[model samples]
Target: MTESDLTSNFPQQSGLPGEKRTDELGMRILKAAQTMFVRDGVDAVSMHKVAKTVGIGQGTLYRRYPNKGSLCMSLMQTKFDCFAEAINEYLRDAANATVFERLSRVVSSLIRFSENDLDWLKAILQSGTLKDAKANIFESPPFLFIRDTVQRLLEEAAAKRELVPLDPAFASVLITSSMTPELMFYLFDSGYTPERIAERYVETFLAPLFAGAGRI
Candidate 1:
């Protein structure tokens, strides 16, 4: 996505009460933080260093992003927005594709997104941001977008009687849970490449669920 798209997707209420900053400044901070994080690793970078790099006061940076977790979350949000848009665009353009094909691609996309943003995700988790009600990630916009998309596709397959009768809602929740950062990290630690994980996920989960249709 473009810089504007990232900036547009930035959370307005990311900081403490009454925390406010211009979009331009927010984008600048995000860019600076991301650069430092990518160059030095999230664990090595400090909020003070980020402010120094951005030529902003530490207090100003703190007001906009109370912690590294909040900053990482904002960065992840931008990536999530791009991920959501890519899936939507693919679905729209793949109107001729079978529900099975579309679903597989969507699942693959989600896997890739998780793998690509693993660093930021890990940082966010370690930062204790996930404990916040406002950052309850499962209910976040981008995650919900993908989860609903997956459910809708499952519902479509069910409607056509192409799959075994199943509860799409529960199935979607299960499938999305598999792709979470924590699970993905475990799979990675277990020596699973992203490609292998996607393939195995489809085979172990989707193939059986969709067995009735011979989509596998």
Candidate 2:
């Protein structure tokens, strides 16, 4: 799907106090952060720098986002919302598409989004504040959404005898784990293009699950 298609599906929220103003400020902060992140490396874009760039006080920034990790989470939430919408739309309109085709599209879309915003993704994943000892990455909204969606798709494919009999839950975990942010970055840095990575992943990992259904 196009970037415009993904963005146009982002949900419009309301009901909170000063919701409009809050969203406005949040957008301003994200824009300032994105600019700094692109000009400098993610490591160099401090919360102080972001606040100063947006012409806001440190306290005001902290009130909205207690740390860089919080800001990054907000940024990721926006991207994930768009992503989830894209997946839903594809599933709705592509009823005639094979389960493997639908699954491949989801994987391609995710990889493209990551490559397009690698810097922000790296920053978010590496942020010190996000390193909570008790936190489960699988429990995060984005991860859960992806895992559940993939599992559902795999289950449907298996039901139709399009895929070999297997545990959808385990397969979904395997798929998502292979596409973690760190692994994707490493592959990119090691001279693998996103398209090549996606192709290889489907060939080596997903294609085999289809038994004799052939390559994706």
* Error at 117, model 2, angstroms: 1.2
Best by TM-score: 1
- For all candidates in order, the CA lDDT equals 0.82, 0.80
Residue 140 shift from truth in candidate 2, angstroms? 0.9
Give all candidate RMSDs, comma-separated: 4.0, 3.1
lDDT (tens digit, per residue) of candidate 1 on 91-161: 99998898888988999878887887778888888888888754576787876887799899999889988
Which stretches of model 1 miss by more than 4 angstroms? 1-21, 134-136
TM-score of each: 0.86, 0.83
Question: For this target, which candidate reaches the highest lDDT against the unseen true structure?
Answer: 1
